[model samples]
Target: MFLKSYTGADDARIYHNEGDCVVRYVKEQCNRHPTNWPVEPGTIVAAYAAHTRQTLYLEQKDFCNKNHPLGLGKPGKQPQRSVILPMLTPNNRVLAIMEFDKDETGFKEEKIHYALAYGSWVTAALIRKGIRESLRDAKEYNATILNCLKCFLHEKLTLNQCISAIMITMREFIRAEKVIFYHIIADKKLDADIYEATSYNRDIFTKVSRKIDLRKDFLMKDVAENHVVVNIHKGDEEQDFKKYNITDPAINSVLCVPIGNPKRLLGIVKVINKVDHPMFFDIDLVNVSNAGMYCTSIIFYTAIGKQLDNTITIANKQKVTLTRHMIPCIHDIIQFRSRPITKPPPYYLSFDWYPTKDELSRDLLADYVWWMFNDLFEGDVFMEKFDVFVLMCKKGYRKTSSYHNFEHAFCATHCMFVIVRTCSQKFSYLEQMALMCAMLCHDIDHPGNTNPFLKASEHPLSKLYKFAFLENHHSNVTRILINHCKIFDHLAPDDYKAMVDDMHRLIVATDLAKHFRKKKYLDDLVKDKRFDDSLPAHKMHLKSIIMTTCDLSGQFKPFDRTREITFSLYIELYKEGDWLKSKGLPVHSTLDRTRYLDIPQDQVNFLSMVVIPCVQLLVQMVPVLKDPYTLSCNNLDIWKRVSFSKLFH
Candidate 1:
């Protein structure tokens, strides 16, 4: 009903791209009004257009022709001619594809052009309608949840009834097959209290209420104690079922949320197997978790005769922090075919080389990364997966951050390439690869806040990582992406293990807090003339030192560029400091925005103390590192000379 059109065609269809596949959103018959009929993805003309984001015109010269159309012959009524046009958003994101067919005459060029023009209006209208409908649906859904909570709070519904009703509501919204609630009995056993099923597994629910031994069930125990959600999308159903002691073959995916605050144990809610969607996404997890919070409150009030307002508030805050740190979904995983790039200038490998915006744009960076990757590694498997790995790394970086964005990651990676290229013979191939991966993902998913700020603010990440907080997080994200893309799938077992170990070591070495200690260790090795690449300990020390050098390579860029990068970094740091001050938390002097006037001197001190020392040590180890070392010293002098007032201007 949303899109009603008569194109003098026999039939029409509308397709929407949903995470990796194209699904039919609407279907029409004999130019009648279209109906919203969702269908799984297939190799149809509309799907092909969505995949390629290009228009396709298929003409059947003869009605009885048996040859498959475009090698994609689905069981359907064959039309004499059909044309598919992809509707795209402003950013070229595919919204839908409109397929027009004709039983008698083919679409002329003018009609196709007209359809293209009409698609723009249709896309805008559909987006506006989607926004309005989403808001309306959200409001109604929230009201339904609130009504359930009110019924429970007023004692109009028993605990089981209230929770079961809420579960049904949640399952409906999430379109999940079943929502099961289990009550914890004195920290020893999990007793299923409520089991609500939509379809397909009604018989399994009776058996699903069996008690689970908390001591024996390690996964369930972890969920109850640590308040961690277990979200399994695919490929681990059998193993997860064994842990839960379930035999339901229909459950392909699962999302389990713990229902309690930090102070006490309550229960766990399991949302199993999304109906139509292939996997449970972050939004689904969020919805189930929020419902679990409501259940936690309801169960607590029923037992303790008091509301858990403060605890629930704290739990919500913790959930927000956890979700913020959750792995971001990779929306676009299109294979990147390497293209020819204008070769970098003669000084591209120099420490002072700074790429223009045109040279470092997203597409150009992809090209540069691919070219540089091929130049370094010759493994056929690595070459095949390298494109996806680069795409994942780029997607992992939070572009909203002022300083630690993809641009900075790529620049640091370029600096690492310079080091690896110069010392190709010194470091083994795996070590060089580790260095590149570490630099490329060293600051991924950065919240643009410092470690002290995270600790003082009681962020969930601080609880997860007590030391080298952000570095560990970045390293973890990098590892997840690497595994997700299967970048090293073809490496020998020992080589793969060594690659991961070295990458983790190199990534954590980028932590600035540990810089002084690492610097002193490397300095002692060099001063005592005991530095040897043959010794594992000494080699690790050198790798750690060089990691710090590449991390701070921004300090050695041309003076103006260094100033720009430094200012961007302060912008993020000062913002965190402002938040900390507002929250009455301890703020580091360098992070404090009120001390902006002291920034130039602070930069001078950091470079002289941290940057110069690290680079100097690396230069001693690898004489070719002198270029960046000299640039660092010169930048330090420049920062020392600039007055605070003129520096900002």
Candidate 2:
């Protein structure tokens, strides 16, 4: 835990570079000790004394009064003495408290005042550390803002998008409820009115495309003509809006920052209503004003059909950083929500729990993941971690992919679920968990390109993870998201690590490179009669085969669904092939869009080659799971009649 102190300016609050050991020690001891001590009151009092230039010295006897009774809530060891000395600034305000707490120790009452000298040194050291951290944070934040600004420096965005981007940047920096950018259309004389405005009011942006009376808006006029920023608060907005005869609800605060070259103003950036803080300061003005300059460049370059320079000079590279909430869960993306697969479907052996075509949404898949996990572990008290894990899975398979998307993940999950049911809960809890998670996160963040294309083109992802091709890279990204989100915080350390390893193994096994090796082993295991479900290694081999089968589950669905899946896969492959060929790289024969093969024949080859063999191995291990194997055979028979010109008919 950390507490911030305002050591630089009145509004500039900064925290020390290191954690407050006092809080950590006190809190940890509170949890570990048998003493039912209240920590909050003492911590607050320490901070208060640190802020108000006071010191507190409490002995065990002092706490033996009616409030504490020998400093024991339920008869536990009590601290002999506690000391909190104010670390004060030169102006006599407390910067912080330097506390020393001891159990079964006597304090030198005469030399206790000597601790006052340590308070000054501690205050100075903490303030210095805070300054260094504040500087580093400011540097990093500036670099990030610069990179975010480059996103707006493009010609592809419509004028409205550009305008919205400008206001968004301003509002984020200033923490304002509203931000408006008004373009100053200049006459030949360079005189202009603040017209063509776009405003982000509260949540959504409303395009206010109208000419405003410049004489009535003196703040904008002052900013445009004098090229100076304006900040007004404390009920000043009421009079300004009244002066313009505008009957809208009045804002509490307003800032007008000029945009464009210093010599000539091209636009005005107006921000209003600081949400997090009470008032807008110089820092907010400076940040919004700097961002407005980039907005000007975007507006000018875009209007002329010329690309604005997006080159960033910062050391930090820009990335699409998403928060835990921003990471799209099933709830975030889906239009409808329903829970159809309420209980285990009838005939868990056949496992024909199919949803209507209209019920296909990311929400259903997310809900299904939760429902299945709940069913598998009936006695589990809560599943907040598992719920977040599913959400992260939905988000990990972003919209960039066509075939390797969340829907594909859901299909794979459905197949795995069916197989699990067929096996009659033969798998352990951890094994089932591994299989389900692996199916959901197998193709996360796929780039629509093949391993061969990635390796040939010298992609950074391939180089970073050289062993397992794209599978390892996918596994890498999945782990990164998982660790960043920290969804499995409830698991024990060893259990968490084991589960992560299992998930990684399952995902990496999806690569075809591991398929034949695992298959050869599985073949030998079956031949030697050494395939024991009780053994972890044998279970892993079974899981590998199951993973392979589930990944190719698209080919085992009904004819319409199989055809749809196959077309989507081919489309993605062709797109990759087009990119590879355009880059003057050799393309795989199957993915070559121009050199087209018989469409259904290609799928027939995939099912006959990959799906049939995988399903054969799976059903051989678990004889009851022959339904999916049969379905794959039926789909292959349907695809045998498909031709390129009239495949659907």
Candidate 3:
């Protein structure tokens, strides 16, 4: 309620809050005058509010007459009524005193109550605004950390380099002058070895003494032992600075956040003197404090190793294969007739030409990816990360499939690359990265069987994922493989999470069960020019659509690749059909091996139904992608001829 704010220790009613923050008096009525909200404590409006603890009303005369000195009165206009409201917090603390300067009349009881009701909503909005602002700040803080990591630590990482990058990143993250990383050596001393970042986001400044010998300083050691973060400014808890004379006074404000987990103190990151303010803010405190956690996670990871396992140990009924599924090491880097991808080659021919069982090159795949994304990941990081990623893709995919192997993955990946290259102008670097990675591992660990075969056979994985069994497994396992090796350790947590999550959705969208639904969704989007590239949701939806066409793209390949894969599909389906008969289950007519001639007819049917419609939809979206549609038409023509020949024979 609008009570008379005390002028002194006494209960004297006065309107003297002109210089306050929460409550104040202003000469002008505008939004910027938070420090000077106008006061009318002695008026009838305030008295009525105090008496009722509700909205108070005053007639034009009562508001503008001698009783209210704060009322604004024009020379010729008639005085209007005033509605004084008490804006309160949930705890009933008066946050602000609100007043409608002019109203039609004070006699309308319903209008007064309506304004009072809106005041309650305003209270909730203010509270929620604080919460939203806090969350926005947190997101921005995290983004800073991620940006630093993405920029600095992408390639050829050494311990010193990682530490230096982190030190500089933490410094820039909080806009501090100097960021020092203290290495806790044998619980004795925190040697300040890592470097610093100056203004303009440069890492040039350094201290003469690279070590903080904690054995000599008791006060500094106490702070180290307690594992506490101390942020000290001139008047703000200056005693926090008094306990430790570790930094220079010219530095002014100092924030020391200890880096470690619950187990042990790994190090302490000390940032002295923020650039903008003489004293650090709460946001600065939060950023540096969080930097400790990120530092610990990195230290823990670095301490362990980045040596990626070339194999996944799969335990089965027979035995535990210590290195069951393995991707062979790159004996040599593929010498691509490496040309710049100014535009996509008609249909991924440069990558998948004259494909053979023994001629597949992991290095070739890695090199093409490195080249394609080199713009985004320049320097050594692109080569380093994609080298590991390519191997991980190979290791994750099963060798059981004649088709759907890493070679097919490579082919499919190149299709996605073509799609991305065609549509690259619209996507962000991260979006491109997510889309590329999604294509690379779309069919990881395939059992060389259809989803129905797996479900009917009651394969463990089918029961596990249940719905999009194989597709979900591919998504989960690929993620596990990348995470296990810590492939994207160079990326910030937020970026890594975004890439991983986006890639997962793309991979899951490859499930044929979700295909028609996703296809229709895109078809609808195209029908109404609803494909807004500016919207993230539309971009992601488009990524899903792109992934679906790319996943089944083996059918749209040129004659040689198409023929080889069609025969391989028969081999896989026949294998499933054989397995189904062995289990005494009635095989579906389409999957029955006895109808071998139907493979071409099925190809024709599939082209006429699933494959052609989706590719046509994609062609509608990206008209430059006419090659795949042409290839689909050509494959349909050949498949029809082959089906007719088989029927006659």
Candidate 4:
């Protein structure tokens, strides 16, 4: 006999072996005639089938009752004893198995051990899945925040715009109760002007100004000086929250972060409480502060842009006014006052002569010229008088020429006044004025040409003053005109002679051929520091050099205007060159080639290389000339390079 207990079937069964490990059963089948035993000994198929069906029905009922699949089996209700056996196969081959009561202590212990092992595997897999989900969520949140920041920066938004954007994004993401932006003024006072409060009243700006002492306040000073974000939490014993007026209903907690450049503190930002969380941490403060830094830089740059725009606008307005008023006056004076006299007068022949014009015209010109002189000469009255005389000559020329083609004469007069004003302060008002009048009339009726033309025409004055220095002939012509006029009879003889000598030197210096010679003379005086005592020789040489330089100083004007003047000179020079070439005559050295027509460029280059250096050297030698000479040199260098590059290039 073999015994077997199977958990799947739930019945303990006894198997009787006949032969060759086979089992047989004796029972009746329901569908066949009732029989207790097999009639045929070989095989009772119906009886065996009936027994198998009965066994299967008993097994199913026992399995359900014992195992209690609904977990309703109680220890008290279940059976305690069961046979242990090897289960038999259908062929009666034995297999190892265990049998016990459903509620047996050993069976329960085995079941508990299996359940715990399965639960542990499931729990561990769930925990791993949770951790991966948390990491992925954190990564996505950070990526979203970074993308928002990138868009904000790319827009080139202003400080207010950036701050507003940040507040909106942070409210949506971080969910803060309030955000405040503060800024420090030059006086080191801080004010919280930018405030965004979602849950609280936003009227903090009006209400809080009196409560905050940001400059000397103990709490703010720490954050500002350290340039660090401070995270304040409720019930934190480390700091005195009462002093800051922090209460539960008000601001229970705050994250204070300093706004700044690398060099200095700009201000601070304070974020108060998390909407969902009760406590805020230093990490939250750091996040907000990092965003605030971009806002601070934008504010600073915007301020700078406004300042530059204002400065440029003011400068442009000043330039326009200067061009409209000052330049025309300067032009009129220069064009009508510096020309040679063509006719001789009788009254001024014996004494050195001085030209005179209509009394009313002279007075008008004098007053106008005096106003300009006063503006330029400021403290010097001597130069003002000298300028008046130059104006008188300009007025005289305008009257004689009927005010036509008076520009060169006026320019010459203006240049002569500038030279005398800059040269010396020694001459008395009357003497200087007389000297200026001589200089002006010394070149009246100039014909817009040179001494060569006079020589070519064999003009009577040229014949009489044959081979004389051009400037001396100009002086003689001036004297002749003045001597014939009854208007200058009020002058003294010796005073007139002294004026003539001074005027002679100034007019002669205008000849371009004498430029090197005059420059060399001035350079010698500069090297010797000769102007220290204002000796006659030093004064004379200084005067001569100044007059010469002033005549050529058009190159040192503003670059654009200088170019216009140079273009005019080019036309004049080109015409002269063409005339000489047509006559089959030898051209002057300075005009020997068409290439030299660009003399303005060459002269500007020379000023940079030579004139500026000379002027600087002179300033070092003569301390009194230091400021004016240095300024002149700088102006020349600047205009020369700028004009040359703009025009030639």
Candidate 5:
């Protein structure tokens, strides 16, 4: 006889002969069913076998006085014994249970093995059926997501129409009772719009309100602040509902997905009451996460479109074009000429390299960059356009900064040239070119201020970028310069796209806030010896580390050069701090001029924490990086000595 273990809405049941007999028990539910069917011996044995994925034998002596469908309870023509075998997939997933009963003749041990052999056939059949169903479901899911994307991209659709289309698609896919979109109206306010897809053809807009305050709602606050998905379901339903402020008894479960990254909160998608399952599963979370990402771009572009319209209005009223135009014929006026490029001096590739005043005055630094690119690319790509591109990047750098100026960019680029040249086999030609280009324009148009200062002072850049203001602005400027110079126009579309993507990623890696996490990831890769140069992900991590190491190359330079660079950075930061003090804002201790005495110790700590570990990892990955690694170690020692001496002074 077949005993199938079935999980019901409120309880679990072991059904004998396809529901000819059933023994019910509560499953993950505290409340008891009104018709409390007594648990039978066969039912218990079958459920146990299914749960443990083990076979069980119950003798007639073990049967209780409870009612049994096989007549064991009354003892007339009853079975003397029963054996329950669990049917399982290859991976041990329970599929069903097979129970056998025998009278006084009893079942021999060999017959039990025969029954087990037959159960495997049933398990295989169930697995095949499951695979077919899963494939069908996956295809449907993909189609729904594609339709949602198409609805979003349709140019003729209104914003309301697009949102409604998305909601309807999500509701049917997830079998949700309702989908409510909580559009973040402002910093502390949200507009809740509810839509119910009772029929696939139509959506009912049951409610719309813009009065919800995020500060007062714990559920939205948690999702927005932490950027987490909140899934609530049965067993803990009462407690979860009370904690998240769900007041309706009808709503038993919820899935709330946040729409943006940690830096920005675009909106939230709340799917209420999953109909097909006890709770939202992993597949549901995956779908909602993807939908949230699409919504982020949609909302961002919609906002940008409005801003662009307003910007045009302002430009029209001022009788001016929106683009920033340089003086006409300025290049001719400056008479900047491109000279024949040659290989850099030996020291230029070493940490001890430092350019003199004559090099800066003669504008020979650009030549060094040109030579590096030409050498790496074998004079194939960017031969003629490179000079123009480098010149444009130079012009983009602001003249007002103490550090993070053109000279700094040049130093960083020179460091990159050394790395790519040493590890030539690890990178392709395009990657080498991208690495050099990223270093060249990484700090273009710098304002000589940190990101936090910009945010605290409410700088214009802060308004334009909610996070990573400096890096994002620098990347944007780099793209503009590249387009203006048309340096990459020679490459095919796919190659050009890859180059641009790599360049942006490399430039963004300069942000030190992300340094520690990236270092740990690289550390793991190195520790496990799992880094394969052929893997794109592994190569990108190495490239990103290279970018950071090159950006901080000054730290491992000769002692005198390192001190000069450090002081220049301190000067720029203190200047910002002085302005902050003037405006009655607090200053970070490192940036505060009053704490200048802590410079040596701070340098020691920075070398210990950031520079040494980074270069050491690079050396482990690429042995040629030992020179810089050794230099960083020496710099840490020097700083330690300096800090000790300061106590006596």
Candidate 6:
């Protein structure tokens, strides 16, 4: 529809077009130009052909003969003769026309250049539009995948189910042939046992299940170590297939993607072959792999939940037995200590309540107290020296109502045991009895509640005893119980004071706020190797630390048992925190509500960080504590794996 125009001093013609085939017409103009320049016609034509190919959508070969044709073919199958031509494209199919006059030189050359430039502009515009469309499509696809993953997370599906669901979505989206999941196990093995092989290839899956050791397989090892997706197209058989034993003829291509856990190698997802068309897998593989990893994590967490539930059941049974026997002994000791002040013996201590007359006897109380002492202390030296201390408390009680009952009696017994264990052979009978009596009465008439209750009641004990000197009040109670109680009328003066000091140190350590300070002191003493001494002071400190250690040793109990006890303790602490908050009081930092429930994740992490270390430290300090330490450690490790396994939903 357009014509070429000529403008030059030399005799040359030009051809051009206004249609889509402008570049082809430009070639015709070049061919018609005079070939008398310094450059050879063939060279100029080749250069023009290359330029046209780069700037326009025209084929390089078709453009070659525009200016000058290179005869490129066999003799019999001769190529077309050289000529410049206008092209027609009325029906979207180009028709070549190699007609042009021989004398259109300089003007033809200018027209050829103009046509080439116009064609280039059109091609560039089309390319830019194509790139924009591709970007939009990619963004939409990514949004879809992210939305799907969020849904899976919200649903809380197990890792396997999540992976399978994701694979189905991805497979349908991508139209892939098969998606195979492979998990990496400890010892660097691939576990194909827990896999989702989608594509309706039941027969192939059966074969794979029977023969694959996923863990030991070479392909899994490579995926885990590299932590990347490996794409293999057909004919790229350079990999040592013999080593992997992957002779399956059906596998023409592979996309092996590593599913990485934040902490370790979770597994791999191998998408095998492409449907509809043969295309090489690329970075899109990572999208599928990430989905698989999410699934694996869900499965792992589920397993841990089951294990914890079982452990809690076992722990509850143990707690019932412990509470029944231990609480009664504790109750009796409390009653014995309060006997001196009440004068009539507390209602709980009367014949109607206890019913047994022997329940209040010194010998029976002494024997029962000694048995508990042995259970806790685990030695014989304290039992033999107990009688001398009992007599001193009896002697001291005649002067006052302080050391009369079993509460002071037990406290005195505990102190005497501490001194006896520490002083061993050097312990004096009178000193042991006085100390025992003082320890027994230290908490006599004790209100069941601790500091928070004291503050709330505005009790006389709370006012007389400021928080800073609360330990002094305990000392005062011990002195009063021993001096005033008629039951301890048999104690010597010097023995009583020493007993008060030992008992004072032990009871005051029960304050949880002082836990860190006590730990620091014990750590320092242990570092100094102070256990080698038999001094009463060192012995008393050791006994105090041991008692504190037991008090805080709830976490080290068997996993099941500890959970039940800890949950109960957690609830109790939570209630206390609530009360303190209501009263506008500052609760302890550790009693924050966020930490009270022992959530599974927190519990597992605590076992790894706090519980294990504490138990190990106890065993290191006292080798005899090894059984509980080892048991707890083993259980924790098992639970961790179980938790991980269950999470792989």
RMSD in Å for all candidates: 32.1, 25.7, 21.3, 29.8, 16.5, 23.8
For model 6, how does the per-residue alpha-carbon lDDT over 338-390 read when each residue is reduced to its tens digit? 45422222332111122133454434554444443444334435444443334
True lDDT of residue 354, candidate 4: 23
What TM-score do all the candidates reach, one by one? 0.51, 0.48, 0.46, 0.35, 0.52, 0.37
Q: Give lDDT per model, in order.
A: 0.73, 0.64, 0.63, 0.48, 0.72, 0.47
- Evaluate residue 97 in candidate 3 and report its C-alpha lDDT on the 0 to 100 scale: 48
lDDT of 2: 0.64
Q: How would you order the candidates by lDDT, starting with the best?
A: 1, 5, 2, 3, 4, 6
Candidate 3 lDDT score at position 383: 48
Q: Please estimate how well model 5 matches the true structure, expressed as its whole-model Cα lDDT.
A: 0.72
User: In candidate 5, what are the lDDT values of residues 1-649, reduced to their tens digit?
Assistant: 2322111111112322211222333334677432222222443455445545678677767654332333322224545676666677775556665556655555667656666776787678877987798679868877876676676677755555566666766677767877777667545434433333335345843225655666668888888778888999755566887888778778868899988667767778888777644467666777776665565566667888999999979856533321133112456324545334645676676666867767778777767877777777755757776666776677678778878988899888888988888887888888998999999899988999998888888888889876678888888778777776678999999999999888988888898877676778889889999987689888888888899999998898888778878888999999998998999988877689999888888898889988988898989888877888999899888888886344344
lDDT of 4 by residue, 1-649 (tens): 1111223222232333221222333245644322132211233222232223121211213433322232111123434333233333333222212233333332344443443343345445644664587467546645655664566558655345555665555444445677776655534545434445434544222112332456455557667766656676666543556665455566666778887753577767777766534456444665676656655655566677788899789867854553233222555556534532123233322111123445234434344344434444466534523443444345434333322223434333455464445544655655455445554564554444456856765666576664444556556555544443323455577765666566666666556556555566666666675654357766565555444444444444444544555565555555666777887877763454567644655656656765455445444544444433554465566554553345665
Task: List runs of model 1 lying over 4 Å from the truth.
Answer: 1-335, 338-342, 361-363
Runs in model 3 with CA error above 4 Å? 1-380, 643-649
lDDT of 1 by residue, 1-649 (tens): 2222435656666766663556653325655433222222334555556655777777765322222223222236677777778887664556787877777766667766777888899989977876698678767877998898888878887776777677777788878877776766544434434445435744233224546665556656667768788877556356665766655667778888887665566778888777755457676777787787787677666766534666678767854564444433444343344334445666777768877766856456755666667779865677787777777677777878999988788778888888888889988887888888888888988988888877877888899887988999898777777776688878899999999888888889888878776677778878898888788988888888888887888899998889888988999988988897898878777888889889889998999888888888888988877988899989898888999888767
Q: Which scores better on TM-score, 1 or 3?
A: 1
Q: Between candidates 3 and 5, which one is better according to lDDT? A: 5
- Score residue 428 of candidate 1 by CA lDDT: 88
| Highest lDDT against the true fold, candidate | 1
Worst 10 residues of 2 by lDDT: 4-13
**TM-score of model number 4:** 0.35
